[model samples]
Target: MAVYRIGEILRMKREALGISREKLCEMSGEICSPQTLYRIECGKVKVKRETYQQLMSCMGQLPERSYASIIVPKNQYLSIKSDIYDHLVFGEFEKAEEKLLLLEQMMDRSYPRNRQYLMKYKATLAYKLNKIDAEEYQRILVEALRCTIPQWDEIDMAEWPYNEQEMEIIFDILHTYHALNLDEKYLDACLKLKMNIERHYMDDDYYVTWKNTVHAIISWIISNRHQYEQSIEYCENGIEQLKKYRIVGNVNRLVYDIFWCTRQKYIESNLPEKEQAPCNRQLAQAYYLSVAQNLQSQSEFIRKKVKQFDIKELFFL
Candidate 1:
């Protein structure tokens, strides 16, 4: 049984409400001090059942149920939240907004800070609906950014895999809203944050993989923006760095493919005539061959691993 301490539950609820510790203390009319709340959330102290119920009741306005009944696997909650966020990023504003409301109700005030994310979703939804209230939307985004800033610091970027798919989804959202400048700023911030994470927390393997992934994506984005030279430079840098670390795996191979594809594309785009440049063609062919060989090796490796698995061990019979 995965039992959470009482304090942990309270803290999660407070965060879900998007209320800061100080704000929670104020809202609860000093029933709990910020320090006390922090202690409780951190599982340093036990909260009285009565006090817990009181706090829950105070913040349970959205969900007409007790927070205790809403417990489930943490990953399940994350998946649901990710799905809603995906919809928001994909321009399904109305549907996302509806889902956000439902999520809020389901959350029952757990992890109140997540309310910031919900607010961001609603603001973006409003923008999609042609509600030209830029001021309000920007305010919500700023609030969400404020909450996210600290989390960026906490994340272990090097070993922690980049959510490339989610990044693309967010990029699309910003593009749809004509917020390219904001998108660029966010990407730059993420890159810097990842660098910090690598510097402070990552092991060698993690650090190498993280750096390569960031560079590859950054290069891809710059290439799309017509900064071909800068893009190629980033890709080449990533490939060199990954090779130095000997990070041989699916991710490394993918990075290699991206580097070669982007390099070839950039060269092709710059050519003056229909005829292929000999140097460019040769380089492209080299990269293509490397990519094919890497993929073949990976497929063979996976087949061997699968062959080693004992299916009978999974069955009672």
Candidate 2:
């Protein structure tokens, strides 16, 4: 007998009947995930009263009509949050989407951050898959940001600092603006987010990852405004941070951004041969780095830019 509490009874009954957690979840119409059910059975999380009742009924156990005082553990919650992020970063979109569904069932609704992450991931996947247009993506992200930043639209991003989750939402916002070529918004956002990063620097693994991501993004943001020197500085900073943290996810893109800015600087300014040499070399290095990273899309993008701009100097140099 799993004699811990009322929650444990669900486990005991389910086991005695030989119904696995997945089976129970399916039988219960997936009102909760297998992990959620396991946590509930272990008294590790508090589900809604209705959810508890439905799950109990699925186990052929009559409800006691009493409240279940279960609460999900901190570590368990963090673990799931990290897992979802890992899935997203690793390009496992389907897995990430599925986990988001499970998390929606399992996570406590009272925590605003839970909803925030859920909304952000949902928006990200939808936009990535072309299921939603730019407006919809921005709308969902703004709502997600509103979960934590009530005055998100009116607030000055640099005026206040944000935590990890808020920064994550902002990162998505940055991506959206850049993709849509909303230069005014992108530049404004870049400055604000940069200030926030400086204000709240944590020694967390998650924080480090976001920091590197921001660095890569803001580099291009700076470059777009014809600030190539500053942009390359930001890119170099991103690369150094990646080395310090041993994170390889964005190193190639960071290098690409560096070349992007440098090549633009040389072409627009028509730098002397001495200066153009570095720019041409950087362009070649960027193309090779994209190939080395096995990112066909990025490599192709560089090739297109090279031909489009008649930057044949890269091939010769």
Candidate 3:
């Protein structure tokens, strides 16, 4: 019964970690009053979507959307959506489709926001199966997002209260555009994300992940112009911010980017190998972290780069 029963699970996790409601609320940047959290944990009230996610993130939970929000206010809908998401995540497309059909059968189709949410999952599944190209996937998501904010394309995002659901849709659109190598659109999305995060996601782990991504994208765009040192500066800034937030997953990737940029910068300057050893060592440390985390793909990619660069003496370095 993959139903989240989010309230119960949240309460259990909180207590298991010996966290009180007041302290958890404080960790969430006071997004909800302690009273509200108590009511939610007691199952006396349905929680807002973003509020619960914020608390969960603060509590060190996975920061991905795994269940439906309270917007639909139906347990059956939430359960089915959770199942669909899990199936999709685990590469069980056929089972995911079955669950999606079950969800479609029960979901109310009149509310536009709810409608867009459904379309979002559908487009994602289609894109995952290669039924649609990145541009088409982006087009579908943008249209869905416009259902809520008709001026999404033109409006300054800072003018509105940030909505996680909408932001997730925009991220989906950005992911597709990034894959398509639509640099202008990708840069615009990253900038909008940076503005939104700065304004709303105060002191949460999600903020660290999102901010790091924005920094990395900005660095990439600068690197494309051959501003390698400038790119390294952005990556280093991102690394420091990630450390300050006490997050780990994305830090090594930033280190890798820094190593990449420094290599390019040195090569472009005709620098001696002695000048390059530090970045090479930085590259080795990032590789070690990837392996420690069991991130096989990233570790393998880094290992291939070590070979390509003939990075000898990494074992001793």
Of 1 and 3, the candidate ahead on TM-score is 3
On lDDT, the stronger of 2 and 3 is 3
Q: On TM-score, who's better, 2 or 3?
A: 3
Model 2, 256-296: lDDT tens digits are 78877877777788876577666656667777766766767
lDDT of 1 by residue, 145-243 (tens): 434233433433323222222233233333433353565665665566456435423246655665666566566566667676676677667667666
| Position 9, candidate 2: lDDT | 50
lDDT of model number 1: 0.53
Pairs of residues at least 3 apart in sequence or in different chains that clash in candidate 2:
45-70, 45-71, 45-72, 46-70, 46-71
Q: Could you arrange the candidates by lDDT from highest to lowest? A: 3, 2, 1
Off by over 4 Å in 1: 1-79, 89-91, 128-136, 145-191, 200-217, 220-227, 236-317
Across residues 145-176, which tens digit of lDDT does each residue of candidate 3 receive? 87655656655654443345676787787777
Question: Once model 2 is optimally superposed onto the true structure by TM-score, how far is the C-alpha of residue 42 displaced, in angstroms?
Answer: 40
The per-residue C-alpha lDDT of model 3 at residue 208 equals: 67
Minimal lDDT window, size 10, model 2:
62-71
State the displacement of the C-alpha of residue 273, model 1, in Å, after optimal TM-score superposition.
Answer: 5.0
